[model samples]
Target: MRTQALGGRPRQPRGGVPFMLLLAVLVSPAALAQGASRGARLFAQRCGTCHSVGEGDRVGPDLHGVLERRDEAWLTRFLESPGALIDAGDPVATALLKQFNGIRMPDQPLSEEERAGLYTFFRECTAKGKGSCKPSPTQKPGTDATPEEVALGRRLFEGTEALAQGGPSCLGCHDVRGTGVAGGGTLGPNLTFTFARHGDRGLTPLLAKLDTPLMRELYAKAPLTEEEQYALKAYLADASRDGSRPRKDRDFFFLGVVGLLAALGFIGLVWGPRGTDPRAH
Candidate 1:
């Protein structure tokens, strides 16, 4: 998008060196370490069977962009016990079962921290995707958030300002914009990591659910419009993917350190060989 001139107007001069919006490609070393720590191991042990980052699907669907497709609560529920949702007439789960030849997904029990780490794995892939998304030179980065998009999203999230309808903003149930309560209201589960969990597929369904029986039963049918959905989605998408990239020169230092320590500990155990206590000798 061309930079807006003064008075909030977009002015593109002929041959005015039309600039491409380049974000601060600053991914901190800490974020990479955090991503690879527990999440990397958890993904390998739990999700590695059916999924690979760039590889296609196996028994089940490919999970590469799952975080972008579904939201956190949906993923948590599905993972905790797939049968509950599949049997209880959940459309998405039903579709999944059919897609996978009606084979049931075994229930998985992941600690909150473990699930959070998996979220990190999903986020890393999405971050790489964002970096690689190439919009046509003529087209604005509409789907992806620019700084201006983020500002718009933030405003839409907080209800201090009003939207088109009498309907309130998203700040009602979920926490966003890093304000109010850290996790927001209790009627709904915390949405802090939702973007990392469901991603696009998950967020897309919520727009339809704005008028669903569940919403009507719960919130007296407080419907969200298409614009509201777009704005809120933008807000969530922008906020959720925030992390720093590790320095390219130095990679896997933490893992190397951990591996070295583990090797030393193993050597110590073997230092006392079978039937021979070195201290005794």
Candidate 2:
């Protein structure tokens, strides 16, 4: 009698493998390629601010041949929690921190799948040799923006035009010079020189993600649209061009002061102290 398996089926040979496992193995390369594409986008959106795959260095070290220099396990651990490794005194992590001017790499909350995708991306880049896989540079509006776009940006910054995503306007938190007589809000830092400070490489990812603590919280749900980002960047570039110069709106200021005095006089006339009439005296 033949040996039987469950459900009255004949038992397979000892060397036989499961069909699902075989199918997964066959399809893994395609899956990895897809994951690598996603990883490239993630790198542009997040990692491009500091680290570059092929470029020499930014705020962090170059990542070319990073996979060859470190094993996948170590890379995964470091990527997941760089701070933890640094605190625990891992020699490599400590050396990297010291090498990069003590700028600690933040802990990334990436899933296992995402991590694998990044590994695949790194591996593919390594295969392509050095300087072959640089992230595409972000296009800044700078001197290339049309006058209409700059005007739209000003309107957007001043809250005259509504943001498409229903997010709060820039005027609520930050101030740029030449906005108006009253300027903008004070909750955030002055942004008159933001473009000068960060330039295109730094500002691109910042505007794309808004990853700072306060901004992340504020825009966690309501992010800026691409058009809004473009417009705002254009306005900021224009502002930064003349940021160091003195305000040129003398007439506007004079008008504002005059208007304020006129309003005060009207208020005083309406609610001034009562005086005896000359006729009664």
Which candidate should be chosen as best, given lDDT against the real structure?
2
Model 2 poorest 10 in a row by lDDT: 1-10
Q: What does candidate 1's lDDT look like per residue over 1-281, in tens digits?
A: 11111112123244222221110111122234434445665665566666566566577777777877898899988887899999899899999999889888778788888888888767876788632322112111223656665566667667755655566666655554364545343333234344554444445444434432223443345555555566666666665555422122122222223333343344464345545745454
TM-score of each: 0.35, 0.40
Once fitted onto the true fold, the runs of candidate 2 whose alpha carbons sit more than 4 angstroms away are 1-138, 243-281
lDDT of 1: 0.53
Give me the runs in candidate 1 sitting further than 4 Å from their true place. 1-35, 130-281
Model 2: clashing residue pairs? none
